[model samples]
Target: MPATSYLRRLCACLALGLLVGCRPEPAKPLDQQLYVWQRQWRPAHEQALAESRADFSTLRVLALQAQPQAGWSRALVDLSRLKADGRPVIAVVRLDGQLPALDLDVARTQIGQMLADWQAAGLNPSGLEIDHDSASARLAGYTDFLLKLREQLPPGLKLSITALPAWLDSPQLPALLRAVDSSVLQVHAVSNPRLGLFDPVQARKWAERWSHVTERPFYLALPAYGMALLPDTGGVPLVESETPLNRGGERRELLADPQQLADLGHQLRDKPPAHLAGLIWFRLPLPGDRRAWSLTTLAAVARGDALSGRWLVELSSQDGLYDISLVNVGNLDQALPPRVELSAEQCDGVDGLSGYTLQALPQHLVFNRQSSARVAAGGRRALGWARCIRIDQGAWHVYP
Candidate 1:
């Protein structure tokens, strides 16, 4: 090759390298943590806490609540047990609606006293979080309250707040952001589905818009729980229970789809802004909390893994009686057929499920699936039982 030709090729390669370096680098993945908001401390939660400690960098626990009467309702966490593993725990102090309306000095003193009590209990938390859903009208008051609370907090301890999305547009947002060490933008709520809870599209838009305006780092609080909406006498949807409803009024379970969560994770990783801190899950999963996501699903979403649907059917016998159950072991709800038929050669009698209707066929027992009995994700329902006084075979057939 000619020397000039080699030189030209080298120059082109150098130019390409420069262009690549000038282009912006991809955003790093968000380092999100989990929030434990169980009002009643349970022994089982310890395991969940420990597991969370292993997976995430930090855990935020609801430690106290400022009641409407200007008193504190403290959560009883076994600090020794929680801190034994040496993971960081941020104590969250939630202020009820009335606190923002109280006298500034009085509220300040009460908050300070709670911090002192926590220290007295030998829990020197790494951070203290204030959770208040301050009304739109109380933005200034809430801002002032936080500023005062910050001054009372011990030096070297971080102060954080759970912020509503609307606050991102408030005029006082900048001052509030400056007052706190960090903020968690709670992007999920139990509202109507015109816009679903934990909508990734809206979440990404919020993160992009607010991250540029806020001076302090902010984390996104995602939902890991479900809500059951029941209709009232006036045909309005009311929150009936946190758990999935299996009987009575019309119910809708609002759960964040795992795919949407994963997509959001990708968006944050691709172009996360300077003020975008990370993500924090609303509540950790408990063993018997049917409305909450299972630990497996939560972990999968955090890791940005694809979630698949699963169905499980089991039959067990005791004292000449057999019980059938249908379980959803996946992270998405599943629909069942209108009726399921069960048959066995030696089955003597069949009892209908209390919440569903049953029809006897010539060779099988048919159980109808009530509209309300549709199984939710991570939900379990009893299908009915059979009395088998004698059995020539240990086989049963189920048809959907």
Candidate 2:
């Protein structure tokens, strides 16, 4: 075949899902969305949502969840505030993946009541998203449930599902995708905890392959949070997110790197899959939500802004006692620096808390980070305190 003929052939097959070798066509910029995964809405949410207004355009709020032993657990969301926000809202219903079987009737009834209450309260949800992590072999039954739910829903209201990449190999996957208006392909924390969160290479592969299986538009559910894995005698570590575990021991912390995710977003924009729509960040961060990204960092990543963290050591004194803190003045979230040192004379006492250790030397007091914990943009961390006579104010240094 001539070069011109081959070029035409490639263009003709670009949008078709028939060949895995076909390259994706250039796509429009993806829209940004967020998952409000908190079960309880508080006054803090009002501020978090307001600050996120400029970046995210849609909200997927947790409406209800199915608990195996306790039946249904509904979220206490502020519907009036949601309506006031004026963004497209998608109500989410979560069914625990661990459940042996789903009771269709109970699910339908609970869903109906929730939707009715929302509608009756004058806040209309733009869509419904079902978040269930069913085993690959059970997708047939799951399909039936979704199909029935779709038929019973009000007309023109969208229905979507939280899809896992593990379903890619299952033959029944196509039918499941067909039952919904869209899907949120969750790419973060889907694998073993040891592998870390948010793999850009694997994520791209999943999105590209998923596009071949579904004709409907789908969003990628990326992580904007962290998790703590506590050692368990049963082999699998106890995974903690948003909620705390009373059992406290040495644990491994995994955080989704903002720079890495931002780079992936850029790649997807440059070469996006067919029918790929947007990104839905998992669980928006609020004040004191230590496991999540700050809104400043999240917004910067969403907009593909430059990332750089600026840390300054400022010491406040009262008599001979001095308080030390590191303040981040830049837009990026950064890992704790290796060491911070301050020149002092005749130090009587010194201390460091959190992830830092304090050392009192002959001429300087050193604060060393003991872990890879990070500080957020525009955030502050206390490096503990010190009591000394005649400390040099101009000799503090922070080492990266």
Candidate 3:
């Protein structure tokens, strides 16, 4: 081999090595990546503010007020405070344990008083949520009791409930859900302190179950406080050593530092389950409480909304001419490659479908199956077909 030729080949090999090194490393999985860091306190708080201002009409904050205690009353007062602070919506009480099977007269009187107190405090909402662990056979009687109570509720006030994931497998579950205007499924894993943070693996599985069970609108209840299941003499939840803690104990106290909350918001944003109307934190207390969760923590979870600029876009329809209009569903927009294969619900060649196809207007971006059409706004109004999907009948997403 000639000396000059040998040197040239060596340089070419070195250049190829440099190109491979310069290419960015493949992105890390979310759970493996270092959490986003906050450079200054101001931005962290501003992030908190941005979350407060984001549109969460689909979200509902569950404020647990069981029976009548100063804590419950205080929680109700705080509901008005948060509502005034611009929080979109909230659920006044959380019902867990065996309360659902209680006689209606007892439950109704207690609930009515809570509603009366909420109204007195200038926090009037017709929707009341009852949250409980799943007991399928008992749900029938529970639904009947709720229907009776609904008849007596202030007209237009809705009744809602929080369900356990196991209910999804139960044949009676859908009927139970039908009794209310909406339902929230608590998706966190319940574990013993010795076991560690709620198992993300199990949590994901349950999230999928609830998502499939409740095909209609529903919210996802996230864990703000961690629970340690005590040793039970038999198959029941033990409370002798009941202490609600989070993933990292004091170090990972979720609601205390803005960053920790942001981390949670980050986790949620990365892996949002389906039919997720919005996120809910466990409980709320006075602005700051170390042991008990507070409105601040709830606010912190709300703060995660800043990352929610996500929209699921799909090419919904294609006319005989093969022109396609991409449909954007949910609040966030999805970035997809041009002219690729996508799921059918995502974009169909027919109106009211979702997927992507390479084509130009006169195109329509129909938001949902029902709406006639929406005007294409990013200035390429060549007029194929443009439309907005409605989450329901009246709500429409603004398109660019």
Candidate 4:
């Protein structure tokens, strides 16, 4: 063929390839709309806020720094309105005393009154969420306070608490989880450097461990907003402002973005561990140009169509050295098929893993250790839901 003819054919083939690669497009404007959520109310995000209808049934707000009677009063009104519209509310009560921390008796009395006041104002919360940065050292006192608060809490009310991520691995965690009705493990990995980097792989491990240990519904509090890096005069992660609130106060730069948040959320959806209610985007009134991005994501989630299904596969050195458990959200259980064979490539060249055999449980796709060895060393694997799994097998397919 002539050179000109050959070049023309190549161009034609390239265009055809591009067309074929594109998947069927999702809904246009409706699917593309995003919600903006922030810690403080601003006229800027008003449009986004009005448009957002993010599902709050599984959402809980913990207003920690809210103080002053008037501020508290306004917050109560907002909570009341939200509850009237049918949304769950959780007010994080901070202890006023130091050292031994106000006597649990006094603490309980004060918090109870606060709750009563809110209830009287026509804002009936599902329950209270106890939060304290100093809660680590004051675990004993805090635990006592929570236990008492739980007892004093009226019937039909629920109790939950915001736990610092550092405390998740604490020896006291078991007892702490035991005391609360639910736990919102503040796994703010982005904000803390000491724990480690933002490894979604490791996050899967933390989620699995917490779910297994706590055996309670918990909120995955994520930093929808990014952190500003402090100039290191010395060899330390220094900043004019340290905490998220402080960072915002100082007007520092942000590290995470909307695209990043979407990536993180999708990663969690795949094998949503047991009792994994949903995600909480830190505190609201988000500061920055990304406000719309956050709100849009929330609205998508609220619509109950946030694309969810991704897996966390961890491969280790030796078979017995580590565990490769998968939290199954594909609805694969004993009632369905006992065993489904996944090929090596399907297993993604995992040397040890043969296939997956789901348990009777609906929320776990755990991989046995012996079976996991087939997966390649130092490699993790995940399976995305290409299509939705049917709720149940039909009558025409009834077994013998």
TM-score winner: 2
Give the alpha carbon lDDT tens digit for every residue of 1-400 in model 3. Answer: 9999999999999999999999976533221101011111222333433443442333244444443223232232344443464543444454545443455676677778766766787777647777655477677777787788788888888777877776766787777777888777665544444445445556567766776766666665555443334444464544311134332322322212223445655665666556655555543322222333333334434555332222333223323222333343323222332332222222233332333222312222333232122211111112123232211222223343
lDDT of 3: 0.47
1-400: candidate 4 lDDT, tens digit per residue: 9999999999999999999888565332211111122234345433433333344333344333323332222222244344544444556664322333445565555667767777787877666776655446667766776787788888978887767666665677778888988877666543356333245555566777888778677776655334445545475664322234332323334433334445656656655677777666543433344311244344444344443333333323242232333322321111111232221111211222334432222322222222321111112333211111211211111111
lDDT digits (tens) for residues 160-215 of candidate 2: 99999999999999999999999999999999987887798999999999999999
Sort every candidate by lDDT, greatest first. Answer: 2, 1, 4, 3
Leading candidate by lDDT: 2
How does each model score on TM-score? 0.78, 0.87, 0.48, 0.53
For model 1, residues 1-400, the per-residue Cα lDDT tens digits are 9999999999999999999999986676678688878777778977877766655778898887877664767777776666674767798888786663745676567667766876776767899888888876788878887887778778998999888878766887888888888988888872354345667787778777788778888898988776766767876666643544455875666666667887788777777867887889878877777667777677777877777766665677889887877677776555554666555545667776746666655556667866553355677778777776542232334344
Runs of candidate 4 exceeding 4 Å displacement:
1-50, 62-84, 94-102, 134-137, 189-199, 230-252, 285-293, 301-400
lDDT for position 96 in model 1: 82
lDDT of all predictions: 0.73, 0.90, 0.47, 0.47
C-alpha lDDT (0 to 100) for residue 69 of candidate 4: 36
RMSD of 1: 4.7
Which segments of candidate 1 are over 4 A away from where they belong?
1-26, 100-104, 120-122, 190-199, 228-256, 316-323, 329-347, 352-365, 371-382, 387-400
Off by over 4 Å in 2: 1-27, 318-321, 344-363, 370-372, 386-394
Candidates by TM-score, descending order: 2, 1, 4, 3
Worst-scoring 10-residue span by lDDT in model 2: 17-26
- Which of 1 and 4 is the better model by TM-score? 1
